[model samples]
Each structure stands twice: as C-alpha cells, then as structure tokens.
Target: MMPPTSSAPHSAGSAGALLTDARLGKKPAPRLRRYYLEPGLRKELPKLHQILAVDLAHVVMLAERGIIPATQAARLVDALRDLRADPEARLRIEPERGSMVLQIEAHLTNAVGESDAGALSTGRSRIDQGATVRRLYERNGTLAVLDRLVALQDALLALAARHSRTLMPGYTHLQPSQPWVFGHYLLGFANKIHRAFVRMLEAYHHLNLSPLGTVGGSGSPWPLDRRRTAALLGFAGLVENARLGRDIQYLADIAAAACLIMNEINDLATDLQLWSSNEFALVELDAGYCGTSSIFPQKKNPIALEGIRTAAAQSMHWFSNVLALCRGMGSGDLAMRSPGHVDAVFETTADMTDLMTGIIETLIVHPSRMGARAQLGWTTASSLADLLVHQGTLSYRQAHHAVGAFVRHCVENDVAVTDATAGLFASVTGLDMALTDAEFRSALDPATFIAACTSQGGAAPEQVDALLRAAAADREADRSWLDTEQHRLASCNAELDRAAEILAAARPAGSHHHPDLAHE
Candidate 1:
C-alpha cells in the first residue's frame, strides 16, 4: 500500500542545478552524500556565512559604483540579513542542490526576487569566495592559538619565578652533567614558545591578504575595487596576482607554524612524562588532570601529559597530510579546496593549543625532589674541574682528565660527591691541590656550583630573575598585538553592519522588491 519512491534524476533546470550537476551529479549516492558532501556542507556553512557577508559588502560597493541597481542591492542585502538571522537555514542545504554557496543563492532567490538575488553573483566566482573564506578562517585560527601560547608562556614564567632557586640537574644524553635551577630549565622552553609566536605572526601576515576580487583565478571582468573589499573585510591588502591568490602555499605556511607549536609541546610533554615517573619523582600533577589505574588503586597516572604527547604527534600527522595534499597540485585546482583537509589543519592546531594550555596551567611541581636529584651522578663535577683549572696550576685538558678520573674513582668506591675529600681530590689529580676542607666541600656543593655560574643566561638566581622579567615584557607585547587584531576584526564587522543598514534604508517603503525587508 506504499507509494513508489521517486527515482527521477535531479533536473538541471536552474543556475544552482547547472553548477551542482556539473561538479557532483543529478543525484549523488546516499553514502557519498552522508560521508563527504553533507558533512562538508555542514562544516562549510559558518564560513559560507562569513564569505556571504563580504559578498554583500562587495555588492554594496558595486551598487555605489552604479554596476548594480540600488534597489536590487538593497533587496539582496535584505535576503542576506534574513539568512544571517536564521541558523537553521544553513542546515537546510541538500547535496543535490549544489554547494553551500549555490544553496544560499537558491535560498536568496526564494526570499527575494530572482533578479536581485542573481545580481549578487555578477562579478564573482566560487574560486575567489572559497579562497577568501579560508584566509579569514586561518587568520582567526592563528590569533586564537597565539592567545593560548601567550597564556602558556605566562604560566611558565610564573612557575619559573617561583622556582628560581629550586635546584635541578641539567642533563646531557640522559646523564646528569651539571647543576642548574629549575627556573633556568623552564625559561629555555619559554624562549622556544616565544619564537613559535613570532613564526605564527609571520604566517598570519601572509594569510591576511584578501582574495575576494581574484575571480576564477585570473581577475574579475568587472571593474571591482579590491582594496575597498579588503578594508571592509579587515584584511591587510589584496593578494594582487589572481593566480597566486588561489595558491595553497598560505595553508602550507599555517601548517608549518602548527608544526613548530606541536614540536615544542612534544618536547615539554616528554619532560613532564619523565619527571612525573616514580623513578624521577621530580614533579606531581594535580589529581584533576591525572587518572588512577582501573585495577590498581595505588596508581596515579599522568594521563593528561600522555594525551598532550599524543595530540602533539597527531598534529604532526595532520601537517604531513596537508603538505602531501598540496605537494604538486597546481594553483587553483579544485582539490586544493578540499574542506576535510583544511579543517583538519585548523582544528588539530587549535586542539593542541588548548591541550598544552590545560597541561601547563594545572600541574604541580615538587622542589624538594628536584633538589635531591640535583645532587646525584656528580652533578658538580664540572665545577670541580673548573676550580682545578683556575684555582690550581693545571691546563684545561689536565683539569678535564682529573675530573674524569675523580668521577671514575667515586664510581669505583661507591662514594657520593657530597662526601668527597681533599685526599680524594689529590689522589685523582696526582697533585696536592692545596685547599681547606670548606673550600673543597664548597666546590662539590650543588648550590655553590649554581651560584658560581654568574655568567649571562646562567642558572644563577639573578640571571633567572632577569630572564623572567624579559619574558613578562614579551608577554605584554604579545597581549597588545592580540588586542589590536581583535579590535580590528570587531570594527570591520561593525562597519559591515552599518553599510548594510544604510543600503537597506535606501529602498522605498513597502516596496514589492522584497517582502522580508519589513520584518528584518
């Protein structure tokens, strides 16, 4: 008793139909739509709205230049406003109807008249629109990740400030080689993060160029004001060459920036994972960020640190995928506009930033354990060698040999460095290195060794304090930059809204051009 299901192919009876049928099909398979097309459209809807806002600005400019009729532009702007107000309208997009843009056009035609809705696409192509959307997305994503990086830097500086005198062993090839304050170790990572911020800013500069007027990878036929559109959309300038505007190089640049950030996160996670182990016990994470073994109640695992490492590794994989997708593809290839590839790059980068920020903000440090470990493996051996070279009559090479022999002697006798004596020193160097007991003990003390490293950028407390101050200043500058960027974007949106309002007012009251104008 059920009616027969309609299997008729979708008819190419309109502009939307023509574009959709050419790229997809009259009727795409359900699995393809569910797996690729529908998901792509859903993800692209927000970006579609953003690009449409810019397109409305373009239409306004065209109207001011007498390229489009004033009444038609007003009606188109009204339809755009209607679309903006209704979030559900974006979800109404069907795969058989074409891309999100085409569907939006179809919606506009239904809301406004066909003539005015069609006029909106007069001087533009999907190529330019797609490029501009991606640039905007990347620009916003870069600023967001940069904000997180600054916060992480702030957290690190705070921890470093608190631990300026907290002694820890500096390692070389997994072996304790020298004594340094934990603050100095933290400052090293902070500097690397600052560099990552700089690199992201460079990439942001490149991606800020507007591509809205580079129609179809060549140029628009109409006399369009590219700079005007750029200013209206808060872009720095135009991409200039149409072909280059369509290039995927900017995406690759973003990927590279992401790779830098993830690499730093990986390094930090590696350190935290090692330090939190039972053998090291140098730091303990907060219970909120850790987990216990399902079968063993005694296990407190640093699960968040492990997750950060995994996320960082996944970011590298996403970067590789983006690079491979763009490797040899010529400029303006449709494949370069793949939504899944682009989304993976942006989403993974943002996720990694958030993960790292959470990890840095909540973890706890144990200074006593760090100090205890700082004294092991003869961490002050280099200081002792330097003391022999300077305070005793020995060549530098002779001093090194003496320190090597001394370490071997300690190993053989199983004696701690703290228990070393003048007799032991004389036996190793084969000379009566004259020094009082206090002086000999001072040379082997980790705290004394750290204090004696008064060179610039050393582990000395004063140097660590100076580095913390520098990091604070750097964080302030980055905060100022972020504020400026956010204000610019906000101002652009306000300007666009004002422009739309002025255009909408120009239409005659109760005009038959668009009925929704009154309600809007």
Candidate 2:
C-alpha cells in the first residue's frame, strides 16, 4: 500500500529534469541538485563504494532471484553500477506535499531518468542511504588518515637520522636532567606517534565495517549479501545487526580514532612550541611553516605549530561531541540522528591530516643549537651520580639522594654542579681527595654519558640504534599499506574515468559535456 516501494526513485524524463530544477532556489551555486554532488561535496565522497557497489550488486542479485521483477532489478542495478557525474551537481529539493520532502540528488542522468522517483529510493529510504554514505566516508577517510600518518612517521624518521649525533639536554621537573643525542630526543616523539598510529590502525578496523544494507531503522526483507558488499568496499564485513548498524555505536569508532590522532598532535605541537621559543631555541622550524607578526616585525611565529595546537583542541572537542551525541538517545533512529557528528568529525579529521602532512613536509632540524644547549648545566651531573653508584661508595638510591643534595647546594651557592660534586662526594665518603680531570671530563661529555647507557631503551647510541631500526621496519610496513591503498584509489579513479568516458560517448554529440573527474 505504501506505493509498493516504487521501482524508480523519481518521475521520468522532462519531469525528472524539472525535479532537479525545482531545488535551484535553495542552492545559489547553480550546481548539481544534490549538494553532495557539488565539487566540494563530491570531493568528500568515499572510496568504500567498492563496498556499496557490492551491496547494490546484491540488490541486483535479489532481482535476479525473482524476489523483485527483472525490469525493476535491472534499473536498480544500473543505477548502482553507473558512475556518471550527477548532472545536478549540487541540487537539493523540497516537495511541499509529501513527508519525503528533504530529498537531495547528484548528477542524475539516464539511471535517475524522467521518473519523479527512481530506484535510489525504491527499496530503501534516505535513512538507509545516509547510513551507507556515512559508512563509505568513515572507511575511506580512515584509510586516508592512516596513509598520512605513515608519511608523518617517515618525516620524523628522516629528522631523527639527520640529527642523530646532535646533542640536546634532556629534562625532568623543568630542569636539565642529562645530555642525549638529538636523534634520541626526536625518536622519543616518534615513539609516541608510533603508538598513536597503532591505536588508529586498530580503530580503523572497527570503522571499516559496512552499514549499507541496513535499510531504514531495520533492514530490507529482500535477501542481501552484506558480506559481499563489505568485501567490495574493502570493509571487514557488515555490522551484524540492523538496529545496531544504524545506532550511534557505529560512529564511535571514528570518534575514538580522531581523539587519538588529535591527542598525539596536541602533545607534539606543545613540545615543539615550547622548544622553538626564544627561551629554549633547541630547534628551528622551517620559515615555510612560520608566519609574520603584525605588532612585532622580528617575530617568526611558528604558526604551523600553533595551528596544530588549536586544531587539536577543536578535534578533542569534536570527540567529546561525538560521544555525547551517542550517549543518551534511544535505540533505533533516535539514538544518534545529529548531522553535525559526521560532518564535524570529518572536518576535524581532514584538517588534522592536512596540517600534520604539511608539518612533516616542511619540518627542519637545528642540531647544533640543540647540542649546545645540552652541553650546559652539569647536565652530566646524573652521570657523576652513576659514577658514584658504580664505585660502590653508594647504592643507586643513595646516589640519587646525594645528587639531589649536590644539585641543591650548587643552586643555592650559585656554582656549577661539577664544583660542588667533588667537595660533596669527598664530604659524603671521606675518601676522595680530589676527583680526576679525566673523571670530570668523562662525566661532562654528553656523548660518553649517552654511550654509557647500554641498557635496553636507554639513551645510549646503541639503544637508540635498536629503536631506530625497529621504527624503520614499522615505517616500511606503514608504507606498504599505503601503497596498497594508493593502488586501490588508483583503480577507483580509473573506473571513474572509464565511467566518464562511457557517459561522454553515450551522450548526444551536441549535448553539453560534464567536466572530467579529477583529483587535486
């Protein structure tokens, strides 16, 4: 009775064309009838259609199975498979008479036809269509983000290598604690990024499931191969339950991934902002990533780092918003119907990815400055403590306490730790007449201290070497995954191009041609 789930989504021919024209008042851009078909919107479309394609194929299979008639199934199948650019590239429509008034469309052509209603809405409602679109977005966006993360990892690796021998003062409690290789310090940040990457990759798997066939709040009665569709889109599989698929639970994975990425970015940005300041000046960022100051002409502001910091704050807020959106709502459709959740999450993610990629591309090293900073402040004081511990005059715990006392005395007396350490050691042990120059120099040489740290995960060059090698292998694995994704996207583009060519050929010679599908 409910219009028999009409075979076609819209009316056919000139009427269908007018249906596109009907929404012209809403979108002043004079573009596609569906906003999603606009250049900007189309750019956001996901590649997981390889999954949607499968779902649609199953719909065709349903028709083939005689669950639906041959003509209707063929039309639906054709609509699904067709990749023509929406003629109404950013068109939206509002029908005054119907409950289904909020419909929008994109690049409607032969498949959409002259019908006022087409197969796009035949067996499914906009609720289901929106869900499918969202799934495609999440799946593809996750893949893209992972790729960008890999690039960032590569950039950090190169930076670490470039500054391997560069020295820097390691800090604790806002005071210099020890001397370490610049590479070792850079690798510290890299380790954080690596862990974040791993968390995101695991989150991606959670986001990669298909939600396409979960029609409306439930699912279609017709037989559908959700698994086949997921495989097509490269998703792990469908969300097993229909109601759960449409619930806010599905979107939470994306939110978690966004939070992890922004958290990592925030930490790194804060560290860079602090280190790049006049007070620290341990590293000099490239001019390309900086900005001019209006009030202060000499200011070479680290705008990139600042922007990342700001973006991270916004992204964290987005994660909260997403979680809040899912928190109190009822089951079925009411649980998470907010449009902003998907849109904001996507925007924040896209912004973060672009910003991070740019930072990686333009980042520079100032190893000499870093090393010089490390050389000051009996930064080697810790090594002297280790020396005492090694000589059996004191245990590590006792040495730690003695070092603290020595540091306090030096600070109060306004003398360097070396000056105080000899007297303090002699006072404590009543044995040392005078610590040798060789001993003092060995403790002071940041390099020797670093090399002496031979334990696992120590700042010793060898320990850092092991970490660096492991990071390299991890980076290589990330690159390999990126290569696979790149190949997949390439194939999508090729298919899209082929579809465009086919459309161009099918059109009447005098008909206006659509622009070619292209990437930025």
Best by TM-score: 1
CA displacement after TM-score superposition, residue 89 of candidate 1 (Å): 4.2
Query: Which regions of candidate 2 are displaced past 4 Å?
Result: 1-59, 67-83, 87-92, 95-122, 216-218, 335-338, 417-434, 485-520
Clashes of each: 0, 35
State the lDDT at 32 in candidate 1: 74
Best by lDDT: 1
Q: Residues 104-205, candidate 2, lDDT per residue (tens digit)?
A: 222223334423124444445545555555666666666667776777778778878876667788877868878878777767767776776677677766
Worst 10 residues of 2 by lDDT: 511-520
Off by over 4 Å in 1: 1-36, 89-91, 512-520
lDDT against the true structure, per candidate, is 0.76, 0.60
* Residue-pair clash count for candidate 1: 0
lDDT for 266 in candidate 1 is 85
Measured by C-alpha RMSD in angstroms, how accurate is candidate 2? 7.5
